[model samples]
Target: MRKALIVGIDYYSHITNLGGCVNDALAVRGVLERNADGTLNFPTPNVLIGTNDTQPVTKTELKSAVRELFVDDSDVALFYFAGHGYLEDTGGYLCTSDSVDGDDGLALSEVMTFANQSSAKNKVIILDSCHGGSAGSNAIARTMTEISDGVTILTASTATQYALETGDGSGVFTRLFVDALNGAAANLVGDITPGSVYAHIDQSLGTWAQRPVFKTNVKKFVSLRKVDPPIALADLQALTTHFPTADHDFLLDPAYEPERSPGQENDPSIPPPDPEKNAIFQVLQKYVRVNLVRPVDAPHMWHAAMGSKSCELTVLGQHYWKLVSEGLI
Candidate 1:
């Protein structure tokens, strides 16, 4: 089972209210609730949004929800917060609606404690507020951070930076985050993990923009979401079959190009395409489309086949070949 607590506080009685945090939370909930195929991903995320005229999200409420979220012995427990952040001599705090000078909402260190001690197999915390990078940092040392095993943290900015809003009811960090969850961070087989999400967001932002922070202590990453694969699974698994070895090249001939078959307009002199070879070529073409295979000494797969040249696995293809050989794919 996977559980998520999504909090977005836009209404604060004692401080300047944000306009985009609620939207960000809702957007996150939308994506987390369903996968690309409309299958359930996480059960409808527990969303807590603070808006005008509503009972604001108090520190107690947020803390209780977070505790409940992590207490379960589930596969994954994810907490996402988008709101005001406070950093002072006391450390970083996720501010609540009633935040004051001495009393911020929940301390970042406290939240990390919940995550560190959680029964869940995997704990993921994503913060999209100012000084969010302080989430994993040491309060006293300020230079070191402690992350427990199976815990991962992805924050919007460094300790001193401010998370930006686009002025259109969307945060700059969250906009990219939503995109990442929607497949921008997906691998060839469509798995999206926290590491990939961070990579996507990190590269998308310019040097002058706020930097995203990632901290983790895990043996393997958990897939946060899945999308349609760029290449079919059967084809991916066939990598080893096609190459025999990673560096091996599969020879091609006119029989591999259906276009060179009899009755085709331009290639009457070429031998008709062999049905068996043509079928194999079709799969090879799929690999070529995704950059797993490339024509040798020819500009295109068609040219390689028609000229009786050869095709070889690309660097990425070799990687997949290794996976296939080891039954890892």
Candidate 2:
């Protein structure tokens, strides 16, 4: 089976405050759990994770947890993080909660080394923190350091930019991130592929907050191949490897089908109204209190609310699913 390690830290004793990193991490876990199938190609990911707000997330604990999760026999393994992060100056490092000004911060290379040693064939890293940019504090290391072979790294922004920080809510980068993930899979884009995710979040963030940025590095990696959506357990079984994409062809394939194929399949000319998409949409509607489709015309309170959109629902749903599936919610 595949494996996934999700970590989120919000309440930092000395680390920077992260209001929504842990929430985002857990939400990712939810999507992973619902999507996992125990087939040879598409196996359920065994999840391992820790959140700072819910529980104490220590550096040593995190290191050990990662080692245990990325076993030699694992298949598709994923590593996700949402928390306060910074770029260090001395040796070009990304600092985490445990990081100190001098030498405590975990080096990006160090995390990559652990990931490389894993046995999983396909691996992905998602970071929702900005690389350092403030000139005074040891120039932030923006270099795209290699983490692992055949590993894809998706960041909220490039080394030079900082993720958006609204009044007192999720970082703009991560907020848009969860939305894209939950919403992308069911859209015509097929499953929420990394590239598609980058596109949606980057655009939304740019529109909402000008400086918002998202970036990724694909080193010796092949793009995801789309398969028909899972209908039955048998269908899931047939899909040995299913990583949905936002490609037009995948969405339009005559033979390819999705879980909630509505109007389109039977009506031919019409497209489907994704219920999973609707559920998420509803959650967003309830939380944000505005129709995403009609946000421009909605009340000003929609924009003013701190927890707009089904942010809480999506976040909690993902967290609960990950914990139940991975045995570590």
Candidate 3:
């Protein structure tokens, strides 16, 4: 069983309410639920979300969820928290909606304790809040260095810096994190793991802005997702000869053939209509989406409007065309 507890808080009457934390949490969960190959990773049922619906995450509820996640020895437990984190001399406290009085929210150290006590074969904790790195800096983490070989901790930033939220309704750290899971961090074999994800985020974000923290005892990484690249080299190569010339528009739809004269056709440049070629062209048309991977650039984009010239090939289309021509995908 692969279980995940995703937490994000936007409603905090005590502290400043964050705008993108909830969105960021959902994005991470969404990416984790599926791989780039369109295969399911951790399904919706295995992933628990904590937000306004389950918000004001009291210490008890958070603790219970953490306990439930790691109860099974064979399960892979992953926890992610994106909210405010307050640090004191004692420990770091991740602020929940219920935390009203002081920084007395759910203690991250205790959270680590729950994670450490887990019987899970693999346990991963990702902290996306402010000063979340403090959890690994505590006495327990320092003293008990070899508690478990499968435990991995990934923090958004160092003990002092705040995790930034983007204008696009996602934390900057989480956006790249999700992107890595989706495809960015994938190896040539399509496997994407925690280590690769960390590398992706680390390289993307400079050390001065935010320094992500990582502590892992596992030798082999557990894969989170697989990235399957589209656009087959064979498919692209097969499309070459039919491509449009520099001055001629490749007719997208055979039905859009201009009225042909009976005696003789004036345009030798245009290929005469043929049923066999039209069938293959129609089948190939499936690759061209409007404005995305269109073969033509101008009018009559989809279904061939009356005046729509052969839709021009997009930049991406041209790139693939070149690659195919050069025997590269």
- Poorest lDDT segment (10 consecutive residues) of candidate 2: 243-252
Using TM-score as the yardstick, the better of models 2 and 3 is 3
Best by lDDT: 1
Report every candidate's CA lDDT. 0.91, 0.48, 0.70
Q: State each candidate's clash count.
A: 0, 9, 8
Q: Name the runs in model 2 displaced over 4 angstroms.
A: 36-54, 90-98, 132-148, 166-168, 185-189, 207-329
Q: Candidate 2 or 3, higher lDDT?
A: 3
Who wins the TM-score comparison? 1
Clashes, model 3: 8
Q: What's the candidate order when arranged by decreasing TM-score?
A: 1, 3, 2
Model 1 stretches with alpha carbons more than 4 Å out: 260-269
True lDDT of residue 217, candidate 1: 94
Error of 1 at 264 (Å): 8.0
lDDT computed for candidate 3: 0.70
lDDT per residue (tens digit) for residues 168-284 in model 1: 999999999999999999988999999999999999999999999999999999999989998889889988888999999899988888784445655567787799998999999
Error (Å) of candidate 3 at residue 198 is 0.7
Question: What CA root-mean-square deviation does each model show from the true structure?
Answer: 1.9, 15.1, 9.4
lDDT of residue 109 for candidate 3: 71
Model 3, position 201, has a per-residue lDDT of 93
lDDT of 3 by residue, 1-329 (tens): 67788887777766677788878878888888776766777776243334553455665676677777777785578888888888777767888776775367888777777777778878898999888777755454543433367889888987777888778778888988988887888754467888999999999987578888788878778987777734333445555665643233566543344434454255565446566755555545544632224544444333452233465456655665665667654
